[model samples]
Target: MKFLAITLIVHTPHPATGVVQSTTERFREVLDNAVLAEELGFDGFGVGERHEWPFLSSAPPVVLSHIAALTSRIRLFTAVTTLSLLDPVRAYEDYATLDHLSGGRLELIIGKGNGAAQRELFRVTPEDQWARNAESYEVFRRIWREDKVSAVTRFRPGLKDAEVWPRPLQRPVRVWHGSATSKESVELAARYGDPLFSANVTHPIEPYAELIRHYRERWRHYGHDPARITVGAGTAGVYVARTSQEAVAAYRPVFEGNLALQKSLGLEPVFTTLDDFVERSSALVGSPQQVIDKVHRYHEQFGHTVLHLHADAGGLTRTRHHDSLTLFQSEVAPVLRRDIPDPPFPWGPVLHAPAPAATPLAR
Candidate 1:
């Protein structure tokens, strides 16, 4: 399976130091982390977009463009770009440029954002989010595929036989629709013959697994090859260690902080206890064997080719975060690489680049 390191530059206080990174430090860390993912043998790197208090990743295209300049081999992705609130023409132009800048190593995953604050900023109603998301994607797809495009969408510019500049490096850049709790997104993905990526961070496996089932069935209904259908899944958190006990003890405070944040948002918490957190949720906190077992179980449910692990500092110290990732790379990854099935696509070859500890990323 193809593995990716996904992050949202959330600016919260560090648990150990009780000090928050300055805007400068946060941005630098993001770039450093992306470069680190490349050096660590990660297949892909994704940055999430959220125009809210904690998240500093409102501009995915700009950040990705910079990553393109710094790194050579790792594919860059927008973990979830809020397409419903964007102007499709502008979004197409921006990403198309990034595709060239990155040497065609760009993948996009679009979604209707979760935050109400962001929806309000774009004057989008909760009820209209699905409609706008579908419409925006339609326009975006057309602009990317057609040289001279003409469209009159409600939320986008009415093109009068206009052509977008700097056509993408890839003839048609691959897109993955990101779905959390929406059937609309799933159907949209199936209808377009694009892949579906489940936002499995918020809930249990059953719901997301069912969504993938629906996507596959719809793919058949749409007369697309069922075998060609691709699915990508997200994990809640990750931390590998020498022993299960050590892993749990070290990650408990950060886990509690994550739960507290979810509670403050008034959303239902998925995993209530630490034991259930490790068992049910996608949080991979355990020894190498334990982590491998969990991943195999998830593959049984979703049959996904791509898996993304979120390793946010999440109130943990920077040192702890790096330790967890290093241990995971050294111990867990090699075992899974041999045991799990490879991703269906011929992704050419694994790429690596020099680490850039200096480049600053927007939080």
Candidate 2:
């Protein structure tokens, strides 16, 4: 299975200490984490895009450009570009530039991002969000694939034989639709033959599994090859330790604090306790063996070959966080790599080797 490290670049105070890093510090930490992810052998590094408070990831193209400059070989991804709130023409221009800057290692995961405040900021009503997402994505895809395009879009100004410049380095950049609760996103992805990435962080695996099943059914309905269907899943969080008991004990404080914050914010609780959260939700807080077992269990239902682990340190100390990642790379990934099959298409940047020269005719 392919592994990715993703962050939302949330600027909340440390859960336990209540000390918040300055915005500059937080961004630097994100860049440092990207470097660390590459050093630790993650296949891709993702930066999320959010336009509201507590999230400083509003400009993913700028952040990813810096990351691209600092690293090579590791694929750069937008965890979920809020397509519903963007102008497709401008979004296309930025990502096209990013694709070139990253040496064609750009992949996009688009979604109708959640958050009432953000929706208000973008002047998008709940009723029209899904339609806007679908329309924006349609335009975005065409802009990438075609040279000149003309379209009448509801959300943006009509394009009349408009030609977007500096086409993407990849002939057609790969896009994964991010599906949380909506079949709209799933159906859209299926209709276009794009991949799906489940935002599996909030609830139990069953709901996400259902979405994947729907995606597969719709993919087949849309006349796409079943064998080529690709799915990726995200986790709530991860903190690995030498033993399951030790890991749970270490992560308990972080979980309790975060849950309390959630309650204060009027968010309905999903899992009442840490143990329940670990068991039910996608959070992987345990020994290497337990984490591995959890992933395998989800894989049985989701049949996903790509998995992204939450890279936010949360309440753990930097030392503990780094150690946990180190343990995962050293212990868990190798086992899962052997057990799970890879996706049919290349999961990372496609490196082409020189073709063999024609040989003399049996001289």
- Per-candidate RMSD, Å: 7.0, 6.9
Q: Can you give the lDDT of residue 230 in candidate 1?
A: 93
Q: Write the per-residue lDDT of candidate 1 for residues 1-363, one digit (tens) a residue.
A: 788898888887765556778988888888988888888888899999898877899998998888888899999989898888888888899998888888989899999988888888889999899888888888787767767666666766577678888866776778899999879999999987899999898677999999999999999999998768899999988888889998898888888877776777787887888788887898898988899899889989998878898746676567877888887787888887877766666664223322322111101
Q: Model 2 TM-score?
A: 0.95
Error of 1 at 183 (Å): 0.8
lDDT of 2 by residue, 123-193 (tens): 99999999899889888888777677777778888877789988677767889999999899999999888
Whole-model lDDT for model 1 versus the true structure? 0.83
Task: List lDDT for all candidates, in order.
Answer: 0.83, 0.89
Error of 1 at 331 (Å): 2.7
**Which pairs clash (backbone N, Cα, C closer than 3 Å) in model 2?**
none
Q: Which stretches of candidate 1 lie over 4 Å from their true place?
A: 348-363
For each candidate, give its TM-score against the true structure: 0.92, 0.95
lDDT of 2 at 176: 95
